[model samples]
Target: MENNNFLLKINNLKTYFYLDEGILKAVDGVSFKIEKEKVLGLVGESGCGKSVTAQSILRIVPPPGKVEGKILLHQKNGSAKKEPLDLAKLDPQGKKIRSIRGKEIAMIFQEPMTSFSPLHTIGNQIMEAILLHQNVNKQEARVLAIDMLDKVGMSNPHRRIDEYPHQLSGGMRQRGMIAMALSCNPSILIADEPTTALDVTVQAQILELMKDLQAKFGMSIIYITHNLGVIAEMSEEVAVMYLGRIVEYASVDDIFDSPLHPYTKALLKSIPKVGKKAKVRLDSIKGTVPLPLDLPPGCSFYARCGQAKEGICNKDTPPLLEAKEKHWVRCFLYT
Candidate 1:
């Protein structure tokens, strides 16, 4: 039985892609929970399974991808009892999962340009999402869609509504995507690098807008990003992933102030701080991420981890263990 405190719980999730070469474990044995109305940041470098984990939750992984384990969602049935639904067990194209997807859990993809259809007007797309889960008519859907656009800080929403994706600026397009994702009043929102392609100003604007919306709607969010600064600003909790696994999980304060895993420490050091002396070279973690098919036998991060032990890190995998209250780290150093 799952704890009633959590809105969504992922248990031992393993999403693998079967290519001709070999099986790619994109998300291997990942587990976590999102509390009601809280934001959880999933942070890592490229190819670290941050986006793949988010996609697995939505059942949107492309072909040859096999998703295993439980994704339990605490769903309210318009009654006092809230039943737990295992999203991984449901058919990907079935009505039950489809209905639950956009209605209960919505996702704003990394890039808005690729996500939106060029042929359709922004209003039409937003209205489509509203129509899919909402019982309102076309006119009502349009009204709600425009309202959402306005809420997301899009100016002249009435005029912008008729514009196509090509007509809007990158920031506006991203805000439009957020409007569509939240139109259904989803309980959980998976924002996968929502600010990746925007300018610094626009990125700040988008983050503030998301914070305001989260406060207003009281919806939980899973924020995926490589930027630790953004993670610190937006998320209450953080999970550091590497090679398809979460190496560290803790509150944002704990992650920044007291990172336990070697990978997490390396990532923090890579960031340039404001007080650093002039002309000083920024620190970087050495070694490239291992390819999915070429992962090591024991700890996948052993090759790249700076504090790896000779026998333990390379010979046996370390389980995720709690180092402090509510802080978890997967490293032999803690064990």
Candidate 2:
């Protein structure tokens, strides 16, 4: 059931990839929702299906992989009261999804160097995006692209529009990517590790820019990142993932102040506090994530969880149960 208050609601989404070795369950039974104009931070370690989840939402899973389950998007707030569309059932290459992808839902990928085409100028790429979704002439699209560039803090927007991806610095390239993603004025933005390769200062600047843009556009955002600091700074709500499932979901303050899952606790403990003693070693979660091809039948975190019990955690996979008001944790400890 799609809630009218939610702009996007994902119900038990399972994206799996079939390979010569075996089936890789990249995203298994994940469900969440993004309210209108709210930022939801998806935090997890590498290979935790965060990126795959985002790609599945946009129907961009590559060949050999298939996405299952409901991804209901509520098309409210526009001129017409359009019916709720199930993105999971839509054809990936069909015109309907294509029109919805850029115009309604946009994404900022991790690496800008690879995201931009080396052959085309920045202006051409952005203008093409605008022309694809909106009914605009080339000249009008060029002007809009330049305006977007200027809004994203690009210096000499007219000159920068003609520049190639390699011509700009790392920060500038990221800003250009943001500009392109926002050019279509999407209703929802998926940011997947947008500050991965930037320096600390530039990372702050980019984060600030995203906040400013979100306020200006009043768009809902799904911010995917491993950095707890970034999550604390950018998100109003937080969902912590392990393996391919969400282990904990709660408000940002509750996540940091009263996390229920062991995995979430370990992640928070790993972050170094600003005024803490310098000589103290940072805490780390023991054991690595199990291989996706051979996932255990019980709790996926059983091998790594220090609080795992013999008969409970090792024998049964706990469902995500509500422990507090709007706080859900997938663990027997909470149940």
Candidate 3:
């Protein structure tokens, strides 16, 4: 029974890292909502806490990383009285969060090689995930793993399944990761740059595969990526992150067509277009992203935002305000 209402609602999520220098606010008061079968693109440059936000949802933040705020999850039942669970309040190592981890929500990491154990076979890993989540025999789990491998477009599924992580190519490894993540048919999937290390063609294939799986399973997705191209391809909604906060959030069409925030506009302009003349210099967002521990007090993007209004953007932090229906921007210009 799928609930058409919001499957996940994250309000004021703050995941801070306790560094020797000071506290690094990785995810600072972030908020978003996702329906049952939609993709939310979490886009930003490196160190913007895109991955941290996803990890926080899964309560997978490493030691010294303190998380705060609410992560509300609404379980889909065949009734109007579906209960929403606050995932943030749950103990980090408790069984409640663990119960939902792979059974209802699963995460596919950025680097599949690092995610998988070197000593374990691909078959063993996928089977383990299946057996842990469901009451199935080893043979049944093995069959499920092979079926998932086939579904993910891995050729020679059985043979590939028996192989170690080192034996597969980068794209194949990513497919294996996807297979494992989707084995349990989770309601929500968090893909942390699933296509980062692949070639353009392979990346397209993976994106298409994810979309196909989403359509098949009706699963909501939170895709974290630095690549705007990938976000535009796979996401329905987009949240542009800067430093550790969301600077802009809107539908994908709105974002690429009429980006409100300066950072979002700069990201769109940075992309190289086809037939735009050879040797033309690419436009880049000026300046580098500041370190997390030493973020600017006002808008984190003030240093690089071309449309930043004089002192207004540098002195006071801007609140994320509703610019239009479903479009939100956090900038003095919008405020």
Count of backbone clashes for each model?
0, 0, 0
Segments in model 3 whose C-alpha atoms lie over 4 Å from true places: 1-4, 76-80, 272-283
- Order the candidates by lDDT, highest first — what do you get? 2, 1, 3
Taking all chains together, each candidate's TM-score versus the true structure is 0.95, 0.95, 0.93
- Steric clash pairs (candidate 2): none
lDDT of 2 by residue, 131-226 (tens): 998898999999999999999999999999999998999999999999999999999999998987777778889999999999999999999987
- Local lDDT at 209 for model 1: 93
Better of 2 and 3 by lDDT: 2
lDDT of 1 by residue, 186-254 (tens): 999999989877777788889999999999999999999877778898999999998899999999999
- The lDDT values for all models are 0.88, 0.89, 0.86
**Residue lDDT tens for model 3, 122-207:** 99999999998889999999999999999999999989999999999999999999999999989999998887777767777899
- Cα error, residue 45 of model 3, in Å, equals 0.6
CA shift at 238, candidate 2, in angstroms? Answer: 0.7
